[model samples]
Target chain A: MKLMIYAAALFAGMSLSIEGAIYGELGKSIGKLESSFYNFFVGTIILAVVLLFFGKGSLSHTFKAPKWQLTGGLLGIFYLTILIVSIPLVGVGLSMISVIVGQMIMSIVIEHKGWLGSSPSKIQKEKAAAVVLMAASLFLIF
Target chain B: MSILILAAAVIGGVLLSAQSSINGAFSKQAGTYESTFLTFASGALVLFVGILFFGQGDISAILDAPKWQLSAVWFGVGYLFLTVLAVPKIGVIATNISTVIGQLSMGILIDHYGWFGGLQIPFDWQRGVAIVLMLAALRLIYIADRKSALQKKQAA
Candidate 1:
């Protein structure tokens, strides 16, 4: 199970990287809204199919998501918009550096407090420092 | 403007953190498909409102988007699946660090090689050294994870 989790993390990283590359290409031709529209549309189609075929639940399960959970979608829109907007203005390297810094700081708070109903874990100093080091590396690379 | 950008980045980070936490909880409770679907669906609705209220572009442009551009939707699918599967297991920081590293590495490669539609950058010693440092940083973080795992094992 632990191995599966780690594998999932690696896969997630690769998937996101590929997505960023694809988005970079798309940003050239389409406005951010249209790009995001197509993205969400395709994602919805794929997830709908998966739910219909593989998921075992009634229609209610689809709509039964909690109110707070909807914030995830709002955040997605914000993140995507800012990312697209920032990249053009700041360059990919700088925009990404900003994003990494943001992600690291927020992730520590989120994980430590278990905000949003996640399992709680305390923030360890070493791990925090490691994240900071990673962020510093972004400055070097970008 | 730089200060504003920095502030926005910080706020964006907090939002992302909250989103990640919510996503983790939803994934655990609702499973991948439903949670992913709901998130996208809700997000689409929000996007729709933005388009309706703030958009300046012609709606027809959506249809006129180039074939390659339209295909970018696949990236969204990949992102959804990844977030659902990864966040709960690895925790937010590790998952995000891995993602940032992967993105930066790929971005550099694309820029350096002019892969796909990427802009070419002259590869030089400084850039090479930077890549090395990024890899080293990633290694350090991954090692930290090993220590974490060892600690957990001892606790168990």
Candidate 2:
């Protein structure tokens, strides 16, 4: 059962990678903000009915949920816009490489601090070494 | 000048991962499409509100956009579907490793030819070595994860 979980996560990750590239292309096609908006538009259309049918939605909470919950959507907007703009300027490869570096750094801090409702975990030597490799790759890619 | 672009990319990646993590949590309580729908619905609301407040409210710009731009939604939808399937099967860490692999492989080709209108950067030995090393490190992490999981299971 656990192994199945790993396989599913791997699949999800791969799909995201493809989506990341597509987002860059979309950014080039329309522009960053529009691309993001369209993504939301299309995605909403795709799932709204199904979500309703599932009877699992709690959208009413949107009104009462803390201000922070609303901020979640902002993150998506920021990420899509940034990548879309950069992908054209830096090529997808270099763009993703740099992003990975940033992600590792941010993730490390998050883990160390246990911020965002996550449990704190220490970054081991191997983890630190992985960051080194990621940095070296970014430099080489440049 | 170049570093700014890289920095932007980094920020973008961070946001992407962060959103994914949060969405994964929502997916837990709600079914796959349910969570996805709510997430995108709220995203649309947030975007429209942000656009109205921060920038010109002229959303008509999207209508003039290219087919690819419009089609980009499919990828977004596609990603949500995959994660819905993957998170339940593989967990987020393993899923992330697969994503990096998928992303970089396409990234290399796209960068090499400047496909999709991105800046052209030919892949060379320097890039080759760096990518190899990065991938190696990722693989090591995956192995370690599996080993630890196995140990925990056995102990239990």
Candidate 3:
């Protein structure tokens, strides 16, 4: 079961790479923001159709759900907008590396403190090595 | 529940990549924000309808729920938009490698800390070794990229 999970993660990782390459082309032909807009618009349509027949989740509860849950759409816009802008200025690899490193730094704190609904897990010693290694790899890439 | 979360997260990651590529191709014709807008609009439409039919939860509770949970949705779209932009500029492999590295690094931390109600998977030496391996992989990719760039320069 664990192995299967790993394989699944691997597959997910592979798709991300392909996505980046294709999006790059799209960004060039149209525009960055426009490309992102196209994705969300079309996605909404397809999902609508699927939900019509198969919907199960209480999406209606969106109102009843925590307000924090509602911010996904807004956050989505922010992330995509920035990505569109950044990829052009920096190469994909470097941009991705920066994102990863940034996430690690923030998540370390988030996890340790149990902020944002995360269960508090104390930071382990190995984390230092992980960060250092990540930094070293980023340096090499740079 | 833990296993389910694991599966969902993994599958979600893969689909996100596919979405980025598809969006990239579509954006070529549609325009950037236009494409992005369509994605969100359509998605919102679907969710709305689904909630009407399949949703058991009260729509009105959104006002009552904690404000912070709303922040959850932003990360995904951000990832998608970035992937679309990066693919064409850097090519797929380079972009993929960087994202993978970033994602895995985060994933490890999340597992270690059990963030967002995820199961806690404490970091151990085995995980440390995995990190080392990841770095090595990064080094290899970097070298390959440099070599190709150098060859292109020589040919030019």
For every candidate, the chain B TM-score is: 0.72, 0.80, 0.66
Which residue runs of candidate 1 sit more than 4 Å off their true CA positions? A1-15, A57-66, B1-14, B79-100, B114-119, B123-126, B146-156
Ranking by lDDT: 2, 1, 3
Candidate 2, residues B1-156, lDDT tens digits: the string is 988888777787677556655654554454456556666777888877766666433457667766654665765566666665675466656777876776677778767876656566888898789789879879766765566557658978
- lDDT per residue (tens digit) for residues A10-111 in model 1: 655555545655566566566667666667767778888889888754435545767776578889878776765554444454455566567767866776
Best by TM-score: 2
> What's the lDDT for residue A85 in model 3?
48
Q: Specify the CAPRI tier of model 1.
A: acceptable
Q: After aligning candidate 1 to the native by TM-score, how far in Å is the CA of B49 from where it should be?
A: 1.1
Query: Which parts of model 3 are misplaced by more than 4 Å?
Result: A1-5, B1-156
Predicted complexes: DockQ each: 0.47, 0.48, 0.04
- What tens digits encode model 1's per-residue C-alpha lDDT throughout B86-145? 777777557756676666665566556666565565566666766565566556656665
Q: B61 in model 3: Cα distance from truth in Å?
A: 40
Clashing residue pairs in candidate 1 (N, C-alpha, C atoms within 3 angstroms): none
Model 1, residue A113: distance off in Å is 2.7
True contacts kept of each: 0.49, 0.56, 0.04
Model 3 has a clash total of 63
Q: Report every candidate's CA lDDT.
A: 0.65, 0.68, 0.49
